[model samples]
Target: MWLWITGIICFIVAVRVIYNRRSGVCTSKKLLDGKTAIVTGSSAGIGKETASDLARRGARVILACRNVQKAQKVADDITGTTGNGQIFVKQLDTSDLASVRKFAKEIIDTEKELHILVNNAGIVAPSVKTLTSDGLELTMATNHFGHFLLTNMLLDLLKKSAPSGVVNVSSDGHFFGKNLVVDDLNYEKRPYPSTFACFGQTKLPNVLFTVELAERMEGTGVTTNSLHSGAVNTEIFFKTNKITDYMFGFLFKLMAKDEALGAQTTIHLAVSEDVENISGEYFADCKIAKRSEQAKDRGLAKKLWEMSEMAVSLTQEDHHYAGK
Candidate 1:
């Protein structure tokens, strides 16, 4: 009886693995031969896998990461394995506004075309309340605001390369926030119960940003969407205590999808012709997934867009392109 039970368990596990592998597959036939793609935080995890996938498909992929040395190593590995020398590394710290500006300027000045922008870099949550140099919550700043500024800065180029795409890697955790506090996004007024709740608040803005951006870029032929990459086994959860981290990591190894599998939706959004016309939608497992009602609030989305513009301090010229 024990032997039969063990065999049954093994069969179930094998079937589950096979099913997951078959689902969420990206069937993009479009070759990005002359196109350029930017994947922020591509030094490791889902970002690295996503960048490598794009490079394999003939796109001039740029690995935008905070750690130049690490990114360079990943770039080299990607080039060697994919035989796509077009992969290059660029320094970008999304939490810092100055760094974001410099990175965007360099890309705009150097790259002639920008077809895909994958805002994949994100942080879970700091154990304590951490503030960036910009005076905003670190998780919120990096996860949403940085990508917000970067996307607006490159809007013109994206328009020039019409039918382009902007893929924001959001999470189902956005539902944890319940509602967005547009007035106090920095947690000055109300305190968060835990770090996870704070992180969830930041993710809410990602979907909101995607909805508003797609609305603004309506006729420009640029599609913007957000996605939940599923529970991925990545380094983002290392901020906890060692014992807790170890336990969580072990569970993730058993339950979470690998980085390559987690990157399928992102890759699909980036290069799939099927979604070429789809915009302002939330996706999971490479399908149009439902989002929390808060994520679907148009008024909330617009309000957040305005607040984000203010937080980023967009210049008059930048506002022109941002439709402010």
Candidate 2:
């Protein structure tokens, strides 16, 4: 019995070693000396690591997060660790359209040029169905709609700063969202089964949005791409119930990648010269990765774009910024 237990432990250790080795690492030494970047939800987790990587590359990074105090703390830490004091903290709650608009306006007014926009802010859906002030489902609103509006609002700036990139942090879990109803994005007609259900549903839009935006901005020099950073042990799970928190904590330590590894694909997309001309593609492990058939459906992407615009109540003025 003891021999069997020892063998099992050895196998688990070997598998973990192999898994971590397979995770991608961004080896680029590219510098972002004059570039500026905004990473939403940067106070912690994958977002925080991504922000730190950008700062280390000499980019002026804005930590756009809902918690100003927490974000400031992160900014200070990045500055101290990277010796890049250009890190700034801005308040942004992606679940709230008002907060999104407010943050976008401040960025446009103060920043002369914008080079990277990482839509990394996200939250796990509550076990119970919930709606935001905008009357949109909480998870969809934060993970998708808010980002939709923010990206369109900042499109002009990104264009003016030619050779810019938008790196959206999507997930492999999008595969579970094959049954997403484009018309019922807010889950009005559909039942919200579980937190996992809502999470997968929202990730689909991240890829679809990238596909459509890439086509729209083809010649504008503003590239858009989405990526799935393999599952990492991040703080997102702590927001769930105690049971889930404990469960994921144990599982993540056993199987998930660390935060720095999780941020590699995002860092690569933001700084890699190889993909300078690449757009509208999904990526994993620092390479162009295949997405689900639905993610590649241009017609569906276009339809979702139109629906999202209306859902966010985007105005004619906002449309002016979106690449026509």
TM-scores of the candidates in the order shown? 0.93, 0.96
lDDT of each structure? 0.88, 0.90
Model 1, residue 113: C-alpha shift (Å): 0.8
Candidate 2 is scored at a TM of 0.96
Clashes of 2: 0
Residues 135-218, candidate 2: write the lDDT tens digits: 999999999999999999999899999889999999987887787788899878978767677788899899999999998898
What's the alpha carbon RMSD for model 2? 1.5
lDDT by residue for model 1 over 1-324, one digit each (tens)?
A: 999999987875785587567558687777889999999999999999999999998999999999999999999999999999999999999999999999999998998899999999998777678899999889899998999999999998899988798999999999886767987888899875476687789999999999999999988889999999887778777646646556776666666788898899999999888899999999998999999999999999999998998998877656425364
Runs of candidate 1 with Cα error greater than 4 angstroms are 1-23, 239-245, 320-324
Give me the overall lDDT of model 1.
Answer: 0.88
True-vs-predicted CA distance for residue 292, candidate 1, Å: 0.1
